[model samples]
Target: MSRTDPQFKLRVPAALRLQIEQAAQATRRSMNAEMVVRLEASFAKEQPLQEKAHDQ
Candidate 1:
């Protein structure tokens, strides 16, 4: 992460943590990058639905 970006403290189960580590290695990304990418994609997917709900 960039120095200007904020940092957060998070805890994960062992199984999930292992999965994330493996995925990050496979994708050649840091664990933080992997998590941020997944979270951003998840929120982006949900944003459209949220907008639709607001319109209704």
Candidate 2:
């Protein structure tokens, strides 16, 4: 995200933090970017299920 984007403090467990750090390094992304990408993927995956449930 750009410097102008809104920012917030997040607190995660140390183990989870380490996992994110490793994943970020493997993917060549900042930790924040890795989190954002994973979060968005989760939402995208859930949306299809949500839409199917709404249709039923």
Candidate 3:
């Protein structure tokens, strides 16, 4: 997606937000991009586990 595109908003705890911001700065990416990448990876990892549990 384009950087200018409308993005979804996620509300996180203050401490978590600070951690995300710090990581974003370290990675040289904006908070939005960093969060999206993290969340996408998490979901990708989780989906297979969820599917396996459902099949059991």
Q: Pick the candidate with the highest lDDT.
A: 2
Poorest lDDT segment (10 consecutive residues) of candidate 1: 1-10
Off by over 4 Å in 2: none
RMSD of each: 1.0, 1.2, 2.2
Output the better candidate (1/3) by lDDT.
1
Ranking by lDDT: 2, 1, 3
lDDT of 1 by residue, 1-56 (tens): 69789987889999999999999999999999999999999999999999999999
lDDT of 3 by residue, 1-56 (tens): 48788876777899999999999999999988898899899999999999999999
TM-score of each: 0.91, 0.86, 0.70
lDDT of each: 0.95, 0.98, 0.91
Ranking by TM-score: 1, 2, 3
Model 2: lDDT of residue 10: 96
**Top candidate (TM-score):** 1
Question: Model 1: which residue pairs collide?
Answer: none
Comparing 1 with 3 on TM-score, the higher-scoring candidate is 1
